[model samples]
Target: MLDWVASLPLWQATIFLFVVVFFRAQLTFWLGKFMRKGLIKSKFGKSGQNAEEKRAGIAALEKYGWPVIPLSFLTVGFQSVVQLGAGFLDWNWLKYTLAALPGYLAWGFIYAFGGLALFRSITNGSIGLLIIALIVAFLVWAVGAVIVKKLRTNG
Candidate 1:
């Protein structure tokens, strides 16, 4: 399914992944912004403990978010939180964009180059461990899915 990405030249692949990361981050940020705006428009965010918590959360995020944004890219789930939280906190555009750009570019280069290298190594000489790891991963996912499905049905 993802073979075409490997076929692309390094520069093209880098650009492609860069755009992918850019759009994904933008979308995640906007989604949070939209939710925040909707909450503001409605009565839900007007006055409450939730509102106070939200305010405090926003303050803390603003104070620390710039530093965390770059580190977020190295993670999986935490990346989304940092990106979305930036928007939820109504972070300034320049600050957030500047903070996030390095991570985005780093991801682009790492994935574009590291992924190609992995595919090459797997195809060329190091298939044994890679295949075993992939098989184990698939088995784990399949087993976990079946268990979850059964639990859902029983519950």
Candidate 2:
């Protein structure tokens, strides 16, 4: 399957990546919905203590969630959370799909081409370079994270 994808043109690769991400995101959304339904059926949801608060929270999420989908796509480690949050909120399928389109395309193009090159690089005996690059990237990320934390704490 991956070999077939690798042989395709760039545009086709992008489409394939888009489909993959779309499927994954949709599946995540569905899982969120499933969990949400379970929660509603659970004892906590049955309790009326926080009914007003729950309603308000859902209202806020639905109202302010439009930007989150696209922004999450541009970040690391936050995409699944936002996608699941949408599903848990029972976001309209159409709305979620539309909001997520840009993210889909961005992720698609990035991974489609980058993944191919990355695979090729590894297969062509660039393992040493790949390892070095990975270490450097990790260091940069770690240093940047520390700097940001210190700035936040000291600012």
Candidate 3:
């Protein structure tokens, strides 16, 4: 799969990345619809609840929705999970798409170059450098994930 992705031309790669992100966003929306209701029931449905509890759920969902689309590239299962969470919270599809575009672009570029860089480094016997680059990429992804978490929490 990595070889196949690597073989794609730059334009094709960009288009593929965009399509993946867009479809993933839509998937999140659909998944959220069912899960949010279940979550609401689990949180406040079983017992007599005030309006405040419902409000809290909505508020949490709104705050977190933006980051889900952007950080979808970092965490293994997290990208899809966040998208679903946003959808369940009833976030606007447009808002999610906007937040996701730049981040996905960044991720796609990094992945494309990173793949080539790693292969070159290893082929040239710069194994140590290759390892370092991989670590750096991981760190960058980690930082991106943190930003996403913060945005989701504070927004």
Candidate 4:
């Protein structure tokens, strides 16, 4: 998949990626909207009703506002949550799209260039480099996980 995308013309690939990201955020937003009512009626809904959760979410919104949309793109698994949260909170469409456009472009560029670079490194038999990259990635993940854990616990 990376190879196929990397082989496309730069502009074409970027457009394709931007569309994909846009649709993904839209889909997630709608999903959240659809699920919010149902989830709130469920047994697990108490968590969302908690004062702490509400306060934390509000604090985050006050601190980050729409910027979280773009920042979320840098994380691997949290973008969906951010998009869904926007919908659940009833964020304005124009604001969400405006924030997400740059994020999608950044995501496109990163995937296009980084994917191609990784592909080249693999094809060139740079096993040691790949291993080192994997190790570094693992360490980063570990540190991020710890930080998130601490923040959650502290908050």
Per lDDT, the best of the predicted structures is 2
Judging by TM-score, tell me the better candidate of 2 and 3: 2
Q: Can you write out model 2's per-residue Cα lDDT over 30-120, one digit (the tens) per residue?
A: 8888888888889987786367656665666666657778766754446887799889888898999899999999888877777556645
lDDT of 4 at 28: 91
Q: Which runs in model 3 stand beyond 4 Å of their true positions?
A: 37-50, 60-65, 115-155
**Where does candidate 1 stray beyond 4 Å?**
49-56, 115-155
Global local distance difference test of model 1: 0.72
Tell me the tens digit of each residue's lDDT in model 3 across 1-155: 55776678876776676676667667766788777667668846556345665666567656644665676665444566666766776677678668877767766675665644564556576776667667757865885687566555654
Sorted by TM-score (best first), the order is 2, 1, 4, 3
Using TM-score, give the best candidate's number.
Answer: 2
lDDT of 2: 0.76
Q: Write the per-residue lDDT of candidate 4 for residues 1-155, one digit (tens) a residue.
A: 45788789888887887788889888898777678767767888756666676667555563556776887776565678778987776666787888888888887776665654764566576785676678657855774576466447646
TM-scores for all predictions: 0.66, 0.68, 0.57, 0.61
- Model 4 clash pairs are none
Score candidate 3 by lDDT. Answer: 0.65
Q: Where is model 4 more than 4 Å wrong at Cα?
A: 40-63, 116-155
- When 1 and 3 are scored with TM-score, the better candidate is 1
